[model samples]
Target: MEDRRALATLPPLRGRVQQDAPLAPFTWFRVGGPAEWLVRPADVDDLLLLLRDLPESVPLSIIGAASNLIIRDGGVRGVVVRLGGKAFGEVSVDGDGIIAGAAALDAVVAEHAAATGLAGLEFLCGIPGAIGGAVAMNAGAYGSEVKDVLDWAEVATPAGVIRMAAQDFAFAYRKAVLPARGVVTRARFHARPGDAAAISTRMAEIRAAREATQPVRARTGGSTFKNPPGAKAWALVDAAGCRGLVRGGAQVSEKHTNFLLNLGGATAADIEGLGEEMRARVLATSGVSLEWEIKRIGEVTP
Candidate 1:
């Protein structure tokens, strides 16, 4: 284990640092345990100083809104950084381009751009994540992905901060091949102009589609599995008769088979166990191996 004492004595550091911070409040599922040390950096300077001074042995995990994550019940070790305040949530429009801080909500940025009659970012209206997460996951909806509109991003590297162009980010279907240790601080997007009414209509349609097909009302980490090539994960799960299946408090969503819902009080192990079962059955029945879309971190209870 790393030294918790050092973190405690590191002055104010301009941001609040809490010991054993409950993670359930931060995550969408509302089921995770605590983070050993949760640090909300007030600004980039605060973050850089903390990172520079912290011992290399002490690990750090960066999270945005926690929409596509599963923090296990045993809690995460080391420091968990969640950027906050005006510095990390700023969004500004410069002509046809938009600059957003890491903590800016995707929906907020999309609405702002849309209000300005920008069209390219309408797809982001349906994504429930922060700008950093949207950039990291290459998050998409309907037909457009973040890669289509992203101009560049600013990242905090071990050596220092650096700006990376869109081409510099190795973007795959739903993955960004940035260094695991790199922390994204801000991003820029290039959106084109379109009729604001049309964009709003399209956003509404997307929201309705999600409501009809996903368990959006339930505690969940969006889709549990990614669609494999040539087949949709949800269709495969439904075909395998996994829909509405329950294991403890975790249930394979009746609305969307690929989504696992925390009906009320589900533990991380229960959800993971149900996921394993779904995978096994899907493989046995359809000969297709489903890959998880949601990132799982931390540990499970013994």
Candidate 2:
């Protein structure tokens, strides 16, 4: 009775269920094993029904457009809930506010806002994750962040649907301390009126900046480590001579040491090992410990 085959015993779901689904294709790192059980709920109602009846002992995990994650080589256990479909991809303009489904891509949200002459969300165009993941982590870039624009978010929790504000989450510097077991479903962000042309121009600049600084085309786990306090993570990594450092099929990006890249055929172990080595090197040289920004999930291959 392996976990992959255990999904059949769970309470009935109103969504598609796949056992032993390969997870590598869903991640930016593109290097992981399978999910023991992957569930994509058709809509919020469907998701809520499933969550309400789900066994308390069964683990629940959610992934968005799926960046900033490392699904280990031995695959995940329990249910990996991915919010998708029309129910989770809609973007609407509510006055000066933009309401987006959690599954909507950050880039798409940016585009929707810009198209509606909203200015504050231009930074989202540069983020690779979807709104669900973005909301979960208070994802940000350049000088702007989600907390600045987020009015409230709809999440499914054990107590049923709840509206959580930025203050509720205590959002700070790429961190959002959400309620345990809550799943973000939708978000409403407040934006100011601006010239559509100006917003588009700003988005273009941000995208261009990312292209110049990051190894955008490579299979990478976005930023491997968060900036340690006042020190830039990349500078410390470079000072430690870790730029372009290689481990198995993974390498620290020459273009951006902050990012760990799969140079092709790298396993989850190789990538994680390289990141740990970076942390050690940086700590030894800078006396400052780097913290992982990427969420590493699942089991390691023995």
Candidate 3:
């Protein structure tokens, strides 16, 4: 009853809203339950309006491409916002700078930068998910991270949209401290003049490396664990004999032990449980506890 009243009081916006929307299709693993409420605002203004007016009591969650995420079986409660479409997926170049909407794919942004002869963002080509998620997590690859190129980002909070400098994010390995309930709208990245062909070649090399070593075509979340200090997560997992380890329908990718795959018909529980098993094995063997890089959310089946 309270949920109905909250829904009725939601501010009208030029966006799509749904109740009990299936969220599996939104993720790379293609496993998960529904969202209690899913909102996709048409533009930044619409987003701001929603943020400003949403009841403080209502739970709000945000998702990007869900490349490195696991949403559990019992579904997420309250509202879940996913930014997309031209309003949040545009990528453009301004001189040596690239401006990308939060929803723009990291690879797309890298391509746009390459087309504009900007070189610094080539690393983005290897990172999965959207700019928003990249910025939030300091996503990196090929010895480069978002912090290396990000100049500033615009985030919409309940108060208003605020432009924050990259340093203000206090970026650390695979993490950033964003404002409470703030949604990244877009970001500006600093780049430099470079040979487009060379940049493209480098991106291609990274792509080839990923395809050869990782499960690029599998139903997998990106890297499952953070590389512990002075140690690669994959190497540790392999050393612990966790390569291709299976639990139910989920398995550690034989190609890359750091990744977890849903081998068709896998539930979220199966995938997560497999990851836990891998962690236990690594800890018992190497005495190095692994931290998850993939974000997990929602409730488990009761």
Give the distance in Å from residue 168's predicted Cα in candidate 2 to where it truly belongs.
Answer: 0.7
C-alpha RMSD of each candidate structure in angstroms: 1.5, 1.5, 0.9
Kindly list the per-residue Cα lDDT of model 3 for residues 142-238, writing each as its tens digit.
9999999999999999999999999999999999989999999999999999998999999999999988988999999999999999999999999
The lDDT for every candidate, in the order shown, is 0.86, 0.89, 0.93
Please give the lDDT score at residue 126 for candidate 2: 94
TM-score of each: 0.95, 0.96, 0.98
| Superposition error at 56 for model 2 (Å) | 2.1
- Using TM-score as the measure, what is the rank order of every candidate, best first? 3, 2, 1
Model 1 ranges with Cα > 4 A deviation: 5-12
lDDT of 2 by residue, 1-302 (tens): 55434445656777888988999999999989898889898888778877776666678888888789999999998889998847798999999989999999999999999998988999999999999899899999989889999999999986688998778989988889877688999999999999988888999999999999999999998988898777899999999999899999999999998999998889999999999999999889889999999999998888
- Specify the poorest-scoring 10-residue window by lDDT in model 3: 1-10
Which parts of model 3 have CA positions greater than 4 angstroms off? none
User: Which digits, one per residue and each the tens of the lDDT, describe model 1 over residues 1-302?
Assistant: 34777665565787888889998888887777899989998788888777777766777888889988888999988889998737799999989988999999998998899889988887887888899988888898888888999999998766677899998888888889786478889999998889999989888888888888777888988878888999999999988889899998899988788888888888888888899999999999999999988888886888
Better of 1 and 2 by TM-score: 2
Better-scoring candidate (TM-score), 1 or 3: 3
